[model samples]
Target: MKYNFDEINNRLGTYCTQWDYIEDRFGEKDLLPFSISDTDFKIPKPISKTIQKVSQSELYGYTRWNHEDFKGSIAQFYKRRHDCEMNLDWIVYSPSVMYSVSLLIRLLSKPKDKVVTLNPMYDSFFTVIQDNDRQLESHYLQAQNGTYEINFSLLEKQLKDATIFLLCSPHNPTGRIWTYEEMEKIISICKKYGVKIISDEIHMDIKLKENKHIPLLSFLDIYDELYTASSCSKTFNVPGLIGSYAILPNSQVKDEFLHMTRKVDFLNSPSIFGMYATMVGYTECDDYIDQMNDYIRKNMEYVQQFLFENLPDFHFSMPDGTYLGWIDARNVPFTSEQIQDAFVHVGKVAIMKGETYGKAGEKYLRLNCGCPKAKLEDGLQRMKKAMDWLYNNQKGGGPKE
Candidate 1:
């Protein structure tokens, strides 16, 4: 099936966080937004069709998450796409992966227990840990030639004191997919320290060329403490559906985890449409994913070339997976806040500042390139305009405060 990935979907009036909430959040109206991780493209037609069919039933009611269809679809997707098999019995449905992470942290450790992860991570990981009263520790990933790698020595030291290690595979913001060798080292270190691993592989399906998403489950044989959370929300662009799942082997840990999920009333029930959408998304939409990855790869390349040629002060690395581009703006003669203000006020564009990710993201900003080529080009042009304004300000007198 030919997927129309280039189709532009106007999200105005849709209450989209990426599009509609920009003005309210940033105090700038009519600005082009490339901030959030959500894609501007439409979900797969087959998945949408399934959602519509479910909606037409008008019988939305209590639904069970342990059905064969849901489990089978998830199992087949992992086994077929990534060459990893997840037994249906090991799957547990959750409202969202973030919720699962929060609950997992609560179940796995006591308050004030250290939760370690990489710096320049998804902000929500920090939020979840702090919200649950856990001490958050970061092992910074070294940026080598614009790409990122784990500083395993630092990680090992941190893991010695930590109780849980939260990992973002095919990491967020920078989008560095850990190699098998890297994964082995991480697993070995965590195993040595007896720190439980919570792997978030939500962006696993967004692989670019020559890069494959390796599920943490592939190492499950060697390490049983690893728990993985993933969802169709990212792959199928259905986050609003509020569906995600965790994969665990049939063991005592799985038993404890499931028991805690019920005891705490976390993700007690499943969404009626969310369940159907997830099943359909995992079973179908394989080709759509391929086409989406290709389009996003082109967008990444286009923005990389555009920034190099037009906005030379901006530094960006091509991501291995995901639609987000982590850009370094330290060379630009402006603070991160000033750069953000210039983009909104001068260039009429809105993007995520690096500060939100942590101190490691000081002069960086994350840009979403999942939209059509025209929109991506327009955003690049706006970025160029912003850079030009900064340049003119620098040359004429001084940068505007």
Candidate 2:
């Protein structure tokens, strides 16, 4: 079936974090929500159909992980898409990626032990560290010539004696797909320091043109102390279902994680339809995923061109993966809060403030481009108007304070 991504669907009053809560978050009801990472596109047909099929069943009893229905689907997905072989025993179901990260921190480190991550990443990584009572260490990615690069030297220094390294592939906000060489270096450093690596590959399937996602576990030969967390929720737009998995190869690390969860009785049964949707998504939604990627790439190209031609004062990097566009808005002559306020109040476009990610993100804002083309165009036009208005109103031919 052909999907029409051009149709604009109303998410307002739907309890959507991006839509329904925009006013509460940005303090403006008129704001267009481009803040959250989720896409505005409708769920894939295959997944929706599977959910409908499953709902026809009368029984919704105590759920057990169906070996063939659950694990088999994931193994097939990795084998087909990532070219990585995953054994059934290696997969451990968890509610979400953040939950898995918290569990790993509690299991692998004592209180106040340092947990390292790249800055300008997903905010949840920092939250996990603080919630688990672990010390947080961050290494900011240095941007050069419109691309972000990891500072290996600083990373190595931070990795010393750190108990865990939380990695974000196709990193949030910046949208970089870490090169294999970079991954190898990270793996080597963690190995030298005897630190365990917990990699979040939730956005693995959202690769842009010419970019490939390399799972951290694929480097198991170099380091066996790695745990990979992934989910179809990001790809399939079903995070509310709360189904995710941690892929662990080392039995020792696996046992540690299980013990931590067991102490808290963390085994919550997944949504009844979540199982069906995940199975169908992995088994039969290749074409849907490809089409979604194509749509997102088109939007990315449009945004890049629009910024270059009209909003030249802003700098942005073409994302290597994911539908997010990280823009450097320092030239716009406003503080991060001021820019965020303008976007919300004047531009009526809700975007993530850079400062929320980390101090390194102060001059940046992350824009979600996973929407209909018309919505994206509308957002850019609004932003252009807002900037023009700000520039015109500035005193002494410069931006106002």
TM-score of each: 0.96, 0.95
Candidate 1 — what's its lDDT? Answer: 0.86
Count clashes in each candidate, considering only residues at least 3 apart in sequence or on different chains. 0, 0
Query: What TM-score should be assigned to candidate 1?
Result: 0.96
Q: What 10-residue stretch in candidate 1 is worst by lDDT?
A: 392-401
Give the per-residue lDDT of model 2 (tens digit) for 16-65. 89998887768777688898888888888988877776677777886766
After superposing candidate 2, which stretches have Cα over 4 Å from the reference? Answer: 259-263, 396-401
What lDDT would each prediction earn against the true structure?
0.86, 0.83
Question: Which numbered prediction scores highest in lDDT against the true structure?
Answer: 1
lDDT tens per residue, model 1, 1-401: 88887888899999899888888767977889888788888889998888888889898888898888998999999999999987889998888898888878887899999999988999998899998999999887787898887888888988998899999988998888888899999999999989899999999999875768889999988888889988998888899988899887847667777777677575558898788888888887899998999889989999989999998888887989988899988887778877876788788888889888988888998998888999988988888887788777764443354
Off by over 4 Å in 1: 395-401
